[model samples]
Target: MQQDAVIIGGGFAGLSAAYILARARRHVTIIDSGTPRNRFAAHSHGVLALDGKSGLEILADARAQLAAYPTVTFLNGEAHAAQGTIDDFHVDVAGHEPITTRRLLLSGGIEDRLPDIPGLTERWGKTVLHCPYCHGYEIGGGPIGVLSTQPMSAHQAAVVADWGDVTLFTNGMPEPDEETLALLERRKVSLQPGTVDVIEAGTCDRLRVRLKNGRTFDVKALFVAADLHRRGTIAESLGCTLTETPAGMIIATDTVKATSVAGVYAAGDNARAFGNITLVSADGVMAGLGMHQSLMFSGHS
Candidate 1:
């Protein structure tokens, strides 16, 4: 028997899509690795009514709401490979039975690789973060630090300047050109050079950044850019085109969320560059509708 849809992730996007499809009387299966990109964040901000809720808390609520729908199935494992075609696809998932579905939705999400700086990874999603809109307000008016990893970091520092006293660290990257320097100086943002050697926690939520040049600075928090990539190969294995964006690369999809391959849809970070809770959830909704519309008219086409 074939499911009406098999969503290859059960994060906010995948779960939201399943709810829509299940409500439409379609049998939906959500295959997730049970680990999401934001799992490391103690709490997520700027996320609608759920703002400030722990990542785990938000997911628990989503899963609980989805439980009422008997048509939606969940498998806690990773998807291995995919074969066959639209309206008759075979999917292999490790440690789970194989699946057949009329439509496939890839919401497998993405991974963020921060620099291997000592203690940097441990502080990420806590004292270290990105996106002022998502986390800046919570930080309030305090000392904030921006670690430069890319050429555009000065721009990032200027943006984060509104949150607090901003310090831009070149961190072994290029010194800010005169143009960028003038802007940060105008904003009263401090600039530091040399690579970040270590990050250490201090009392009262303060962070200490040490440089190879033997310079040290303390601030309430630090921000570093991370490279984002698709978490798995299911999308590429099934032949979804990839595209680059300002934030990161994403799986390419049409407006309705259909990929280049028929009956295959993509949502969440896998399909779009900029994403948050509200945005990615809507991405899944579009994929759900796209899948349904295609199946509804398949008899005639």
Candidate 2:
């Protein structure tokens, strides 16, 4: 019977929960795999007081603050397998001992499948961005390109046009409905219909997208809704119910981040339908309190 609250992911949401739990004098152990979904992003924006800080810097600062709480422990490894139930979960860490805890926080995160375009991976988080609100201001009203991956790209083009010159590139994505196309036209978003052949790095950290039809557009940034895939088999291994959305299947959690399975909680990207750093960090706070209360009341069971 272990007493520590185990947080399996150590990203923003993961760390946020750990700090709150530790402050309450609850023993916490955060096991981080060190593989971040946002490792590609140079700076994490829209976070108060932490804007423009690299993802690495933000995590380092978070871990530093948690150090003040002696009960919080940090381990580096992946969750190869997990067993047991809430308030009594066992997590096996590769190259380390198994962690058995009183409560589990599954925030391992989601993976982004960017379009298979050359030069896009390198420029990601720098020039090739995803959320307009995240990286739009940095582009500063310049030429922007939106690679249509889902039907939402039409809406993305219409919304992003406010930031700068926006071009809707439908690289063989599903054709938008007539109403959506009409809305995009009204927004003054230029439409290009062709498969992107190659994306090359350009001067001044710009991007050059060449099409199969021998067309090109050099833009300051590229926006995409990369198909998201959940990381690891933690949710599945825990017998947690998942919900399906346009994006992908995600661990379904209630208002306080309680999943369908009891004694198991989730926060951050893997738990939410949509999320940003600020939003997920808030989720972590709620989850931290929720787990603490559950532990305090479990003796009544």
Candidate 3:
């Protein structure tokens, strides 16, 4: 049977959409490779009641709850390709038969491309992070390092000062203009113009930021605005409009999460340049409602 909707991800956004669809008795299939963007983090914050739960744990709970719905189905695999439009979408999985659905939802999330620095990868999502709102509170105020990845680093450095004594590591980037320097000075952000050499764990839950010039600064945590890229090509394959945001490219969608291509929706990080659990979860809810309304009015299924 052709599914009413096929959500091509199983993270927070995908699962949340699935929950809503299943509640409405829509036959939905979720195809996911199981590699969520926030899998590296041990805990999730800024969520309503589920704060402090690990992201994986949240997914686990969501999956378990979704299992209670007979209309929801899970497929643990990569969606290799996608085609067709509107009420007749086709998705190809890596190891399974192709799926036909009346609607498609792309929530595959994004991939963070960290800089080529030794020890940075291992520390990411732990001591190294991106958004201050998501992980800043637990950092216990002061001694936070911002590793410059893009021009936005200066702004990030200034903002993070609210959570800690901020250090903006220019890391070979151009020096901030006088106005920006003055802003940083007002924010009490320290500027380090040296290029980064390496990052390593320091004593007592701190990170050691070592510069190429042999200068080292120890901090409770490090922040970086890593370059983000969409994880899957299904949205592109289906010719959905993509928007370029300050964070990166994302699937462009309407307020209700409907992509440019009718009957195809997107939510979560794939649809948003910057996102957190709450925002992406709401994206899923909107997409679910929008798809359901489309189905009901258009009589697709």
TM-score leader: 3
* Candidate 3 per-residue C-alpha lDDT over 1-301 given as tens digits, one digit per residue, 9 for 90 to 100: 8999999989889988898899999999999888999999999999999889999999998999999999999999988899997888889998899999999999885789999999999988998999899999999996999999888899999999999999999999999889999999999999998999999878887899999999999999999998888766777778899998878888899998999998999999888877899999999999999988899998534
Each candidate structure's TM-score, on Cα atoms with residue i matched to residue i, is 0.94, 0.96, 0.97
List per-prediction Cα lDDT, in the order shown.
0.85, 0.86, 0.91
- Residue by residue across 1-301, what tens digits does model 1's lDDT show? 6899999888888987888898898998888888898888888887877888987788888888887888888788988788778889988998777999989998975788888889898888888997787788888778899988777778999999999999998877878889888998999998877888999886677899888888888888898777777766777788878898766788899988999888899999878877787899899888888888898899933
Candidate 2 RMSD to the correct structure: 1.6
**Candidate 2 or 3, higher lDDT?**
3
Model 2, position 273: C-alpha lDDT score: 65
CA RMSD of all predictions: 1.8, 1.6, 1.2
Question: Model 2, 267-295: lDDT tens per residue?
Answer: 98888767788998899999998898898
* C-alpha lDDT of candidate 2 relative to the true structure: 0.86
Rank the candidate models, highest TM-score first. 3, 2, 1
Q: Which stretches of candidate 2 lie over 4 Å from their true place?
A: 203-205
